[model samples]
Target: MPKKRRRISAFFKILTVLTVACGVLVAGGYYVIRSVQRVELTPPPPPSGCTLTAAGDTDELEVEQAANAATISGVAFGRDLPPHAVVVAFATVWQESKFRNIEFGDRDSVGLFQQRPSQEWGDPEQLMDPVYSSGEFYDGLVEIAGYEEMPVYEAAQAVQRSADGFAYDQHERRSRTMAAAFTGAEGPAVTCWYDTDEAGEADVEAAQAEMDRVFGTDGALPAAESRTGDPGWAMAAWAVANAERYGLTSVEYGGQRWSAAEGIDGWTEAPGEGGGAAAEDQVVLR
Candidate 1:
């Protein structure tokens, strides 16, 4: 009887140990599964956008808007116009079309500045072209006497002749920030990011042609080594702005590099001397 009782007790002890072991294993597995679930539930970062920072303020822009803004600023730079001119143009475009190259607006208005064909701004197709429209805006802006010294809204009004001329005032601060960034008054101020799968294959020829058209410098992009200062940074910012359109992977200038893969982080110090074989004065595009 004593032996039998001892055997029974040993069986109960074994059973308790086994039960406790199984419970511990089950608890550990549940914890691991919950941890994996938490990791999987984390959302990915949003893609496809650009930002310009200047004077301690950051402004966000849709990728298309950024490209158009860069074109406008590029035209000004090509003309050797002051940054104030870019500010005026930005204000006008913001009020007119929010920097979008749209086909429709109030009273047959169209394109970036909402220039109407009936009013002889241009044919619809020509007005729809960003480079052409930007050039047209700058052409009119420069003709306004004392426009450089005028308030942003006043200068924009002189060029746009909008019904509510004062409306351009609302965008003055934002315009200044954009002008400063795109004009390279602030180095590496423009940063853009997008998905690589969506960027498509880069078209070097197309990018070169567009740069020539906007900057009016034929064969200049290939000779980026000759460029420097604000002009160099401006060209670098232009490449960044149009990266999505041209499928550009990277742009480097002034010892800093901006890559599409790490674009949101802005410009980082280059690994080698002036972006490796590219001169410090150059805006190297890849």
Candidate 2:
């Protein structure tokens, strides 16, 4: 072949090879992109439990149990009782029913503390109501002389007069941790998460009514700014504890926000002017 012809043939040969290689590369890249797209990119679901941490120790409770624990603590707060009262209540309830408000127990012993109607604690319906039962527990607790200074189990036994008073002792540490969290002794110590899809319809009026019933206040819901200090945090904790039941999407207080969407991450710095400085004192609920 002529030298020019041979050079043109060589050029075509190289061009053909390059074109085939480019097609292969493009196909491989397209497949790689499609494969990545086919893989699920959704985030892992959040854990379905609640945790209360205090003094570097942590304890876990199911969502309902946490709510009941919060109610027990909130009642004491409303009564202006000391955190010790909450500790005693927690220990007693932990021994009695693991924080579950059930209908059956040892011969009509019902509710969180297992108060028996036959023993004149209250009618079964009233005893089954967490707020009433918690109040009754505190009522009995306060009647005892020097309950604040007593061992948790002894104090609980003073009110409950249970078959195994010593059982309360085993739960004292856990009770203390939970009490601290629920009482707001440790700031924002209670963290809870749930499936947002499964959350019930939130009723603000009902929540307010229940809050009033437990706290013994007929007043309106206090603004977060007005309720600064441990009391505010306690209220915030109560809201978090009851978030699932009330369908609370987010709770903002002390410039931090706990969002149901990102609940597993717990509280994060609120977004706004000064990183939620305006919300520092305000507990905005949504």
RMSD of 2: 7.1
Write candidate 1's Cα lDDT for 224-262 as tens digits: 332212777777888898998899998888788999899
In model 2, the Cα lDDT at residue 234 comes to 77
- Per-residue lDDT tens digits for candidate 2, residues 74-177, read 78766788888888999999999999999999988999999999888999999999999999999999999999899999999999998789989999998888
- The window of 10 residues in a row where model 2 has the poorest summed lDDT is 220-229
Which prediction has the highest lDDT against the true structure?
1
Residue 100, model 2: Cα distance from true site in angstroms? 0.7
**240 Cα displacement, candidate 2 (Å):** 0.5
Identify the runs in model 2 with alpha carbons over 4 angstroms from their true place: 1-44, 218-229, 273-278
The lDDT per prediction is 0.85, 0.83
lDDT of 2: 0.83
Candidate 1 Cα misplacement greater than 4 A, ranges: 1-45, 221-229, 273-275
